[model samples]
Target: MGIETYLVVTDLLCSREFPAEDGRSDLGIAGPGYHTAELATSRGTRVADASMREEVMERFHEEREALAGTLTEWWGEPSHMGLQTIRLRTATEEIPEPWARLSHLMGDVYVWEARQCGRWIVLGVADRDPTDEIQLLLTATETDPP
Candidate 1:
Protein backbone atom coordinates (compact mmCIF):
# COMPACT_ATOMS: atom_id res chain seq x y z
CA MET A 1 0.00 0.00 0.00
CA GLY A 2 1.15 3.54 -0.72
CA ILE A 3 0.68 6.59 1.47
CA GLU A 4 -1.98 8.98 0.29
CA THR A 5 -3.43 12.41 1.10
CA TYR A 6 -6.81 14.09 0.54
CA LEU A 7 -8.54 17.47 0.60
CA VAL A 8 -11.51 18.71 2.56
CA VAL A 9 -13.92 21.67 2.61
CA THR A 10 -16.71 21.38 5.09
CA ASP A 11 -18.10 17.81 5.09
CA LEU A 12 -16.81 16.95 1.63
CA LEU A 13 -13.57 15.12 0.83
CA CYS A 14 -11.63 14.06 -2.29
CA SER A 15 -8.58 12.01 -3.19
CA ARG A 16 -5.98 12.81 -5.81
CA GLU A 17 -3.82 10.59 -7.98
CA PHE A 18 -0.50 11.54 -9.54
CA PRO A 19 1.94 9.95 -11.92
CA ALA A 20 4.60 7.90 -10.18
CA GLU A 21 7.94 9.67 -9.96
CA ASP A 22 11.03 7.75 -8.88
CA GLY A 23 9.54 5.59 -6.13
CA ARG A 24 6.89 8.04 -5.07
CA SER A 25 4.00 10.03 -6.48
CA ASP A 26 2.71 13.54 -5.79
CA LEU A 27 -0.93 14.12 -4.88
CA GLY A 28 -2.39 17.41 -6.05
CA ILE A 29 -4.18 19.09 -3.16
CA ALA A 30 -6.83 21.81 -3.31
CA GLY A 31 -7.67 22.48 0.38
CA PRO A 32 -6.81 21.66 3.93
CA GLY A 33 -8.34 19.06 6.28
CA TYR A 34 -8.46 15.50 4.91
CA HIS A 35 -10.83 12.60 5.25
CA THR A 36 -10.66 8.93 4.20
CA ALA A 37 -14.30 8.15 3.64
CA GLU A 38 -16.27 9.25 0.61
CA LEU A 39 -19.91 10.31 0.47
CA ALA A 40 -20.15 8.28 -2.70
CA THR A 41 -17.39 6.73 -4.74
CA SER A 42 -18.74 8.08 -8.03
CA ARG A 43 -18.84 11.63 -6.70
CA GLY A 44 -15.04 11.69 -6.29
CA THR A 45 -14.69 15.19 -4.83
CA ARG A 46 -17.76 16.61 -6.53
CA VAL A 47 -18.57 19.87 -4.75
CA ALA A 48 -22.02 20.31 -3.26
CA ASP A 49 -22.80 23.32 -5.43
CA ALA A 50 -21.18 26.45 -6.76
CA SER A 51 -23.38 28.58 -4.52
CA MET A 52 -22.46 26.76 -1.35
CA ARG A 53 -18.78 26.83 -2.16
CA GLU A 54 -19.06 30.51 -2.97
CA GLU A 55 -20.80 31.23 0.30
CA VAL A 56 -18.13 29.37 2.22
CA MET A 57 -15.44 31.05 0.19
CA GLU A 58 -17.01 34.43 0.87
CA ARG A 59 -17.17 33.74 4.58
CA PHE A 60 -13.57 32.58 4.37
CA HIS A 61 -12.49 35.77 2.67
CA GLU A 62 -14.34 37.88 5.19
CA GLU A 63 -12.61 35.92 7.93
CA ARG A 64 -9.27 36.31 6.18
CA GLU A 65 -9.59 40.06 6.00
CA ALA A 66 -10.77 40.33 9.60
CA LEU A 67 -7.90 38.14 10.80
CA ALA A 68 -5.38 40.06 8.74
CA GLY A 69 -6.06 43.12 10.85
CA THR A 70 -6.37 41.24 14.11
CA LEU A 71 -3.15 39.30 13.60
CA THR A 72 -1.22 42.38 12.61
CA GLU A 73 -2.26 43.86 15.94
CA TRP A 74 -1.57 40.63 17.86
CA TRP A 75 1.91 40.18 16.40
CA GLY A 76 2.83 43.69 17.43
CA GLU A 77 2.45 42.39 20.97
CA PRO A 78 3.14 38.83 22.05
CA SER A 79 -0.15 38.60 23.90
CA HIS A 80 -3.63 40.06 23.79
CA MET A 81 -6.80 39.54 25.80
CA GLY A 82 -9.39 37.22 24.22
CA LEU A 83 -13.06 38.23 24.22
CA GLN A 84 -14.39 34.68 24.60
CA THR A 85 -13.55 31.93 27.06
CA ILE A 86 -12.51 28.72 25.26
CA ARG A 87 -12.68 25.37 26.92
CA LEU A 88 -9.34 23.62 27.03
CA ARG A 89 -10.98 20.21 27.11
CA THR A 90 -12.80 20.89 23.88
CA ALA A 91 -9.73 22.31 22.16
CA THR A 92 -7.93 20.36 19.49
CA GLU A 93 -4.45 19.13 20.39
CA GLU A 94 -2.96 20.25 17.07
CA ILE A 95 -2.49 24.02 17.26
CA PRO A 96 -1.69 26.35 14.37
CA GLU A 97 1.73 27.60 15.50
CA PRO A 98 3.46 26.92 12.19
CA TRP A 99 0.65 28.73 10.41
CA ALA A 100 0.88 31.61 12.87
CA ARG A 101 4.61 31.86 12.17
CA LEU A 102 3.89 31.85 8.46
CA SER A 103 1.27 34.55 8.97
CA HIS A 104 3.68 36.62 11.04
CA LEU A 105 6.31 36.27 8.37
CA MET A 106 3.79 37.12 5.69
CA GLY A 107 3.24 40.37 7.70
CA ASP A 108 0.00 39.52 9.51
CA VAL A 109 -2.17 36.89 11.20
CA TYR A 110 -5.94 36.64 11.52
CA VAL A 111 -7.56 36.33 14.94
CA TRP A 112 -11.20 36.21 16.06
CA GLU A 113 -13.21 35.70 19.24
CA ALA A 114 -16.26 33.55 19.95
CA ARG A 115 -19.27 35.57 21.04
CA GLN A 116 -19.92 33.49 24.12
CA CYS A 117 -16.82 31.78 25.53
CA GLY A 118 -13.92 31.05 23.27
CA ARG A 119 -11.27 32.70 21.16
CA TRP A 120 -10.84 31.57 17.55
CA ILE A 121 -7.66 32.55 15.77
CA VAL A 122 -6.91 31.64 12.17
CA LEU A 123 -3.65 32.15 10.32
CA GLY A 124 -3.16 31.90 6.59
CA VAL A 125 0.32 30.83 5.51
CA ALA A 126 1.10 30.75 1.86
CA ASP A 127 3.88 28.35 1.04
CA ARG A 128 7.07 29.79 -0.39
CA ASP A 129 6.40 27.55 -3.33
CA PRO A 130 3.67 29.44 -5.14
CA THR A 131 1.92 26.17 -5.82
CA ASP A 132 0.97 25.46 -2.22
CA GLU A 133 -1.07 27.56 0.21
CA ILE A 134 -1.67 26.39 3.73
CA GLN A 135 -3.30 27.82 6.84
CA LEU A 136 -2.36 27.61 10.49
CA LEU A 137 -5.08 27.89 13.14
CA LEU A 138 -4.74 28.22 16.89
CA THR A 139 -6.84 28.81 19.98
CA ALA A 140 -5.88 29.76 23.53
CA THR A 141 -7.63 27.88 26.29
CA GLU A 142 -9.92 29.93 28.46
CA THR A 143 -9.88 29.90 32.26
CA ASP A 144 -13.65 29.61 32.26
CA PRO A 145 -15.97 27.94 29.79
CA PRO A 146 -18.52 30.41 28.63
Candidate 2:
Protein backbone atom coordinates (compact mmCIF):
# COMPACT_ATOMS: atom_id res chain seq x y z
CA MET A 1 0.00 0.00 0.00
CA GLY A 2 2.93 2.30 0.81
CA ILE A 3 6.72 2.29 0.62
CA GLU A 4 6.87 1.91 4.38
CA THR A 5 5.07 -1.40 4.20
CA TYR A 6 7.51 -2.75 1.66
CA LEU A 7 10.50 -1.29 3.52
CA VAL A 8 9.44 -2.82 6.82
CA VAL A 9 8.70 -6.19 5.32
CA THR A 10 12.01 -6.07 3.49
CA ASP A 11 13.75 -5.44 6.78
CA LEU A 12 11.90 -8.32 8.40
CA LEU A 13 12.72 -10.62 5.51
CA CYS A 14 16.37 -9.67 5.73
CA SER A 15 16.54 -10.73 9.34
CA ARG A 16 18.58 -13.89 9.90
CA GLU A 17 16.50 -15.22 12.76
CA PHE A 18 13.28 -16.98 12.00
CA PRO A 19 10.12 -15.99 13.83
CA ALA A 20 8.68 -18.25 16.54
CA GLU A 21 5.11 -17.85 15.38
CA ASP A 22 2.79 -16.11 13.01
CA GLY A 23 2.66 -12.51 14.18
CA ARG A 24 2.43 -8.93 13.10
CA SER A 25 5.23 -6.36 13.05
CA ASP A 26 5.38 -3.00 11.29
CA LEU A 27 2.72 -2.71 8.59
CA GLY A 28 3.09 -6.34 7.55
CA ILE A 29 3.56 -9.62 9.44
CA ALA A 30 5.83 -12.65 9.81
CA GLY A 31 5.14 -16.35 9.63
CA PRO A 32 7.67 -19.01 10.47
CA GLY A 33 5.17 -21.29 12.12
CA TYR A 34 2.52 -20.57 9.58
CA HIS A 35 4.59 -19.77 6.52
CA THR A 36 5.97 -16.24 6.35
CA ALA A 37 5.28 -12.55 6.67
CA GLU A 38 2.52 -11.19 4.45
CA LEU A 39 1.01 -7.87 3.31
CA ALA A 40 -2.14 -7.09 1.35
CA THR A 41 -3.48 -4.19 -0.69
CA SER A 42 -6.92 -3.78 -2.12
CA ARG A 43 -7.46 -2.75 -5.73
CA GLY A 44 -11.01 -1.99 -4.88
CA THR A 45 -13.69 -4.52 -5.81
CA ARG A 46 -13.16 -6.74 -8.84
CA VAL A 47 -16.40 -5.57 -10.30
CA ALA A 48 -14.53 -4.04 -13.19
CA ASP A 49 -13.80 -4.66 -16.86
CA ALA A 50 -11.02 -6.95 -18.13
CA SER A 51 -8.69 -4.01 -18.79
CA MET A 52 -9.06 -2.85 -15.21
CA ARG A 53 -8.30 -6.35 -13.98
CA GLU A 54 -5.14 -6.35 -16.11
CA GLU A 55 -4.13 -3.04 -14.60
CA VAL A 56 -4.51 -4.46 -11.09
CA MET A 57 -2.31 -7.42 -11.98
CA GLU A 58 0.35 -5.15 -13.50
CA ARG A 59 0.47 -2.97 -10.43
CA PHE A 60 0.80 -6.02 -8.22
CA HIS A 61 3.76 -7.20 -10.27
CA GLU A 62 5.47 -3.86 -9.94
CA GLU A 63 5.03 -3.93 -6.20
CA ARG A 64 6.30 -7.49 -6.00
CA GLU A 65 9.37 -6.58 -8.07
CA ALA A 66 10.11 -3.60 -5.85
CA LEU A 67 10.14 -5.73 -2.72
CA ALA A 68 12.04 -8.47 -4.49
CA GLY A 69 14.76 -5.99 -5.33
CA THR A 70 15.21 -5.10 -1.69
CA LEU A 71 15.55 -8.73 -0.72
CA THR A 72 18.10 -9.21 -3.46
CA GLU A 73 20.42 -6.73 -1.81
CA TRP A 74 20.66 -9.18 1.11
CA TRP A 75 19.71 -12.55 -0.35
CA GLY A 76 21.25 -12.06 -3.75
CA GLU A 77 19.27 -12.84 -6.88
CA PRO A 78 16.32 -15.14 -6.42
CA SER A 79 15.66 -18.18 -8.48
CA HIS A 80 12.87 -17.13 -10.85
CA MET A 81 10.63 -20.08 -10.19
CA GLY A 82 7.24 -21.52 -11.01
CA LEU A 83 4.85 -24.07 -9.52
CA GLN A 84 5.22 -26.76 -12.14
CA THR A 85 8.99 -26.73 -11.76
CA ILE A 86 8.72 -26.95 -8.00
CA ARG A 87 6.15 -29.71 -8.21
CA LEU A 88 8.41 -31.77 -10.37
CA ARG A 89 11.46 -31.10 -8.24
CA THR A 90 9.62 -32.04 -5.09
CA ALA A 91 7.84 -35.02 -6.57
CA THR A 92 10.14 -37.34 -4.66
CA GLU A 93 10.54 -35.07 -1.67
CA GLU A 94 8.07 -33.89 0.88
CA ILE A 95 7.41 -30.26 0.14
CA PRO A 96 6.99 -28.09 3.21
CA GLU A 97 3.41 -27.32 4.27
CA PRO A 98 2.82 -23.76 3.17
CA TRP A 99 5.38 -24.09 0.44
CA ALA A 100 3.15 -26.67 -1.18
CA ARG A 101 0.13 -24.62 -0.29
CA LEU A 102 1.73 -21.45 -1.61
CA SER A 103 2.23 -23.03 -4.98
CA HIS A 104 -1.50 -23.22 -5.30
CA LEU A 105 -2.03 -19.65 -4.11
CA MET A 106 0.72 -17.70 -5.78
CA GLY A 107 0.74 -16.47 -9.35
CA ASP A 108 4.42 -15.56 -9.06
CA VAL A 109 7.07 -16.69 -6.59
CA TYR A 110 10.72 -15.62 -6.38
CA VAL A 111 12.79 -17.88 -4.14
CA TRP A 112 15.98 -17.41 -2.17
CA GLU A 113 17.58 -20.26 -0.27
CA ALA A 114 17.94 -19.54 3.41
CA ARG A 115 21.16 -19.89 5.39
CA GLN A 116 19.36 -22.46 7.49
CA CYS A 117 18.89 -25.85 5.96
CA GLY A 118 15.41 -26.77 4.75
CA ARG A 119 14.29 -23.21 5.21
CA TRP A 120 13.52 -20.76 2.39
CA ILE A 121 12.97 -17.07 1.70
CA VAL A 122 10.00 -16.65 -0.60
CA LEU A 123 8.22 -13.62 -2.06
CA GLY A 124 4.86 -14.18 -3.66
CA VAL A 125 1.95 -12.32 -5.27
CA ALA A 126 -1.61 -13.50 -5.73
CA ASP A 127 -5.11 -12.15 -5.63
CA ARG A 128 -6.58 -14.82 -3.38
CA ASP A 129 -9.67 -12.68 -3.15
CA PRO A 130 -9.90 -11.11 -6.57
CA THR A 131 -13.09 -9.42 -5.57
CA ASP A 132 -11.36 -7.76 -2.63
CA GLU A 133 -7.56 -7.54 -2.66
CA ILE A 134 -4.25 -8.78 -3.95
CA GLN A 135 -1.80 -10.15 -1.39
CA LEU A 136 1.95 -9.83 -1.29
CA LEU A 137 3.53 -12.47 0.91
CA LEU A 138 7.10 -12.78 2.14
CA THR A 139 7.95 -15.93 4.02
CA ALA A 140 10.80 -17.66 5.80
CA THR A 141 9.48 -21.07 6.68
CA GLU A 142 10.68 -24.02 8.73
CA THR A 143 7.47 -25.07 10.47
CA ASP A 144 3.83 -25.74 9.81
CA PRO A 145 0.94 -24.18 11.65
CA PRO A 146 -1.04 -26.36 14.09
Best by TM-score: 2
Error of 1 at 20 (Å): 32
- Put down candidate 2 lDDT per residue, 1-146, tens digits, no spaces: 56577666655555546556656655455555444555665455468776776787778788888888877876689887766554554567777656666775675588876553455677777665456566677776655311
| lDDT, each prediction | 0.30, 0.64
Which parts of model 2 have CA positions greater than 4 angstroms off?
13-34, 85-94, 116-119, 128-132, 143-146
Error of 1 at 63 (Å): 1.0
- Kindly give the stretch of ten consecutive residues in candidate 1 with the minimal lDDT sum: 1-10
* Deviation (Å) of 60 in candidate 1: 1.3
